[model samples]
Target: MTKETIQKTNPDKIDSILSDYILHDKLHQAVMISAPWGTGKTWYIQKKFIPSFESQHKKTWGVIYVSLFGITNFKELDDIIYHQFLDFYLSKSIHKKIPSKAIRFGETALSIVFANKLGLSSEDEMNKALKLIPQPDHIVYILDDIERSGLNLGELFGYVNNLCEHENSRVILVANESQILGRFNDTHKDKDKNNSVNTENIVTDEEKRIEAYYSAKEKTVGLTIKFQAAPDEVFEQVLNKVVDKREVQNLIRQEKNFILDLFTCSSNNDTETILNLRVLAFIDVTIADLYDSVKQYLDVFGKDNSFNDCLPSMINTAKNKIILDMVRYTALECFKFKMGKNLDGQSFSYLGSSNHYIYFLHIFPFVQRYIKQRIMNQDAVANYLKIVLKEEMVNQRLTKSVFPILNEWWLMNDLKVEKAIEQLEREEIPEGVGPEYIRGMMITLITLRERGFSIPIQHFTDKIIKYLNSMDKISFNNSAFSIVSIFANKDFIDLYNRTMKPVYDYVSQRLLDASLVEYRFLIDLQWDEEFPIKCRNHIASFSSDRRFLSIVSAEKISDKLKNANPGEIWYFCKGIREVYNISNVSDFYRADYETVDLVCKVIRDLIQQYEKHSLNKVKTSNLKMLLNLLDQTREKME
Candidate 1:
């Protein structure tokens, strides 16, 4: 088998068993290969079984493969088998030397003549005409997706029995036997309740269907083999097939083991193994897309080597974190896409809990958007990652130029200390700089003063407070104190609480209250088409205060909802649901509960008002749904 081909389970054993059955010319029964869904059974059979058979018994067997998926009737099954048989026989015929174009032209001409004179335009008529062609001998038939067929199991197995016993054709059946049995039990639970084979027979209809199925299998299916495949081998084959960019491919290849383990191993001792190849394909694509975004982030901000120089070990840890988080996120998305549900607690142990904001990847809004919508928004991702890296540097007490000096302050000479003090004095805090930079400067000055360096620590604190008080607007809020506590050491925390906390809180609160223009713009967008995007951006913004609901105007929102069109109202309510859902986990949105009750009341009133107007039924129904959603959100909050 090629490296790019998915590896079959116990290939040599299967090959030997199948070879024995095929080489025995007088076929009496069909062989069944059984496995769970998405285990690469179909791939292995096509890529492995067919080639081995053709190589070893080319003249002794004629193989015809047919998928029984969605085959509702015997006629449909017959048509498919007939077509496959025609292709297999023609490929081995003397007419194979004839160009396919001439063969197709002759067939089309024959079809036209039959349609006009012989009335063979209908499918049954066409089938009757085609059956006149000579049949090929020594046929080996592969019937796949047997469980997926719409035909009844008893009738389907009977057909296969006839093909094996009467026609003397070798047959291979591929299916998930458990699924077949499960489907039988489910559909036949009450079938023919009054009918009984005998008076002593108290069997349910489900038991009857199962008995009939097994009886047919006993006559037709000679042997059954369980299929299995190594997930790593299958994943590698899929990686080689789907991923195009070599660098991205190599990046994913590094995490092949962890990714496979996530699917195959259950943390809660659950016996079921997913080992889904389709989910693996999605994961490979997700990781490749996210890896590109990570590359772009590095390209944008990697040139500033000072942070790297100061903390190489931390930098390496963070880099490794980026790759692992990418895989974790991809695994989660793939599971949800393929399984149609979120991960359970058992999976959370491996994939990382979304409630934990300590991991930057789990909460990054743009990355979440990319995973769900498949729209990268590269600029947003790059910008978000840049802030995340900066936060990492700040939390580790290493900024661009300031932290290096203070980190090694004791080893530095007097001139260096003076230069560092001068840099802090003259440096203008940028418009969007985090509190960590300000906190870092304060911590450095406090350290200098404690060391008897004659540093004016109080002077710098006064200067910063005055500067912050004089600003026309400030985006930082009281919640920023949480960030301060995160990055602060014992001494800085003491000094900040004792001296700076009250004054900083008053000034920051004033600035936060003053910075209402952005919030107003966002609230006004409830009538615009861009409400959803703007609302998400508002929540995800680093500088903007997310505690808008604590201060938001319910009357204003209700008034706008009254005037907006259906699409705008949908977007508005969608944005509201997003905020309420996010509020369930985000501390930043905890204060939102103070006003959400009022918003819920407004939604209920709107629902009732829209109910009166027959023209606004869509709006009324949507409002009712939104009210129910709000009720659920409130329950979660309680």
Candidate 2:
């Protein structure tokens, strides 16, 4: 028999965690916190922990937060600490005079800056100000972004050591330890392991230097606490900064779990991909900035665009800032006006070469528009890539993989039979596309088929059938793709009805197994607070054709029709309407055709009588029925 224990980290309880770490300390010396970048090392301390400690009404004078990034020397560090110390004193509500010796130095320099008196040197004054700050137990010093600092390592560590031992200072060093260790070799060639970083594993001088640096850090930092912030909390805060929390929440409500599912599925448990804080922040801002514009465009013209490989490919790109930047770059090129001018070209300017940035932007949007316009030839793709980039930039192997990938993405985004036919008409389409690729595209087709696109995919469908037969069933029901871009376009729906219908049936059944299926039941069910998720399209799969949401003369119908209160009228008819009347749901059909149009007109008359509203308002009949139904149903249910 064996006993096992597992620990799941709760970012919400970070305050409690910090309390344990901080209160456990007896050293009154430096306490270092080490966390990977984007784990919210600085945010957690400044926002949550320090405020909490301050709120306790204990002996804590004030906290001074300083980021050491870009600090070039000891003098620069001294200046920052001196100003922060002064700011700390000034933060108090009550006015307090500086000590006599400090008054001239602190006030004179501060006034010079505020008054815009440029020519004066604040150097001697700043040094004097630094000496006056009490380096004792009255304040907490938060030193962060230390890994990026340009200050000499020995001198920096020496200053920290002297502060604790003689000045009675309490320091909290927040940094990424692995990152700082990596920088040590780059900066000090003397300790560069036998002149090569690759030889680091052999007991070399570089390894010794690394060990010595760790030893020095451990000595300077009396206690080390691993720090990580809750990604969810940080995401919420980041999103809330851009849009109202309720709106953002509503936008992703259904897909929130799906986005996380996408994240987990794509990462394959790679810690860097799954837990990277920077990526979390990037996604937050991306959704904030891109959601409304992309959504608006897609909603009106969305039939024309989809984020094919881009959405799932998010995981692959999250590992590098450059890859993430590529997404932003492409979006900016297309929708620059909406993007705001904050970027000012600085992000791209930092990249060593403009070729990668310029070429990717041109190629990315070209691919999206190319697929949307239904140009399916591999040669077309190759020629298009050539037009977009220089000759050397086109990697043939990459383009080969990318061409099919673009095709697969096409299926995911916008797969009307009209567009698909261009690609599907090849003498042997399967020869150019992969089984995995085809499987993914078929799942996209199954989704559009369910949503009511009357595509004639079943006639002579051996091309699709042969590919599907080779694989186990594709489960689209729970996929993120299954939840996006559903529409009621009868002109494009096949509804899984055709000669090759069995395959569609098998795939359809698999996908609809979890959805709210029956039109009557789906309607009659009470709307819970969480019912009708906001962002996700909960696509309906119907079991009937002449579903009655009709408004007609109250006279000719059965007594059952007249006796109906709005409760019975709306229940069973909310989403019920004739999309098309063909026996085969997927048959070549359009709602505007004679039979479909006539049925819709007749039904509209029936529904109008139920409401007793004027025919002039026929356009609002369906909506009126639902509103009246809700009013009456609430009365009935309550």
Candidate 3:
């Protein structure tokens, strides 16, 4: 019936039904398309159904659409419909002679002339004006957001009845009927308490209103079509609009069903299916952005040789796994976050059990940051990916060669143990090996030596220390240095006590000293007009160690606060709050609470200095708030 055919597989046959209704020469009543909100009813009517209808019957009928979302009275509705018809008439009568560029001006001039000439100030006058159309019967009027309209239902439906019966116009209404009924029911509840003279047998005012509503609907509406869209189909349509990358598109295509499953089930209820296309588009776009970042990260780290080395034939499989894991994570997290749920910790728990490269790629700290902030820190993502890739590769090498035999040493004979020890010795520890891996190796070797394997544990320890010394300063500072206490060996415990403990302590103090210097510079930069986010993140980079604290002296801070402008003072206070806010939760920042308290006292004196002057109100207020925050931090820490 229409140019764009609905698939025969679609059992609803809604397109055919609507086509028949629209093609009828005379419409006795308006057709209402009803669905729940966010079910893509509006999108279907305007984008798919209308385009097909128009394409099939061009010039035979004119289409006019109006949204009754916020219309509260008759005149607002009249004005919108009047303008649609005016534009239609202008296009047919006057636009033929006017150049395309001047048509806008011509329409504006004609609108003013017609409104004044017709004196169209009321609905009756507007309807009179609308009759000026060459063939009013040829126009098909589509009104959307009917449930959101503030107009009384009877009055609104009466107007529609006039158009259908008298003006001989076809009308289609798109609405969420549930919302309309729910609103009316809520109104009834509110009024039930106000009515004092309700007799038990009498039909009440609420019932009368509802009856009138249905009566008007019965008079005006010929057919009501319940609208339901397939979630998968709608998601496909939305994804096609938002995603252009072929790889991303393919990944989504492959996992479309599974992704939808994760999303529909993310509410933790198996039976609930949340099909919101607006949310779907947003999630697809987020997935594409995250996938692009992953691509760039992988590009920087070169290709994954893990698959090439271990399963040479499954290279494509490995690549797809990486992309798919990212897609799954992005989809689930976007759904959860946008739905106001906490991050799904279960999705990330695999990181603890598996050292798979795929698991490494699915680490979601960067993802959580991106989702919450709406800013992709590509450099940070790439750097973290680089670190994960290195660790995964090293872990793979160790797991394949040495770790298995060492971990299950009882199954290995004397020759196998000797070979494992030799492999451990020959394994030239990489420069940036994570401390966890290093400690694991040290424990295994020391245990083997204690078990009489002649493992040369001290030589291995020295080599590990040498590599730790050679690691880049930033990487070394960021290392987590995981500690395992399960081992009861005197030698391994003694090694940690004698060597590893002091090394980590020295490294921690060195990092703290360096961070204090950087913190001072960041404090000064905070007063500058442009405090870059890169700078802020660099300051927050030390947050995990809990050693991050401002070391600026109270005298210098007082001098800076006195000279700083309002915006500078605002940013400076923000930085101080952000830095000290962490001190509330961290025991490490407790040592610096005295310094913060002194700064608060300095700001108190500054506020007093500016309190008597009207010119320093902004700076004084900022200092006052900063002092309050510092005071709260001190109390919390105490």
lDDT of each: 0.62, 0.44, 0.62
Better of 2 and 3 by lDDT: 3
Writing each residue's lDDT as its tens digit, candidate 3 over 16-51 gives 876777677354688888876776888888788888
Per-residue alpha-carbon lDDT of model 1 for 1-638, expressed as tens digits?
A: 00111223454578787888777745478888888788788998899889988998775667878888988987777766655655554434423322222222113223454344444467775565444333333678899998898876766777887877777777889999888886764333223556432334333477686785576577778778777666667878999998999987877877665566556443232333446677788888877777766866754575566565645666656656655666665655566556665322111112121111111123355555665677877777777777667655545543445654554676789888878777766665544445544654555566576667776656676777776766766655543432221211345446545655655767656865665555675464444557666666766552145455555576776676677677776776776665666444344454555466777898787777766665588777777776687666655555
RMSD from true fold, candidate 2: 26.5
Greater-TM-score candidate between 1 and 3: 1
Q: Identify the leading candidate in terms of TM-score.
A: 1
Which candidate, 1 or 2, has the higher lDDT? 1
Model 1 TM-score on a 0 to 1 scale: 0.54
TM-score of each: 0.54, 0.42, 0.50
lDDT of 2 by residue, 1-638 (tens): 01111123444665664465344545545666777776677877787778877788233445668899898887777777766665555323223433222332223234544322322265764454444444354456778988989965655676787766555556678888778887765553333546454444333477776876765665566656665455456656655655565764555443343333333333334232233445544444554554443334323321223323233334122212222333444333322222222222211211111111011222233323322342334445444433322221222223323233433433454544445544444434333333233434444445444556653455426666565455554433212112111112222223322333555555545444333233323333442322233101223232212122222212322233334444444432433223222332332222113332343344454566745755424334543554454333223322
Clashes of each: 0, 19, 0
RMSD of each: 14.8, 26.5, 15.1
For model 3, the run of ten residues with the poorest summed lDDT: 349-358
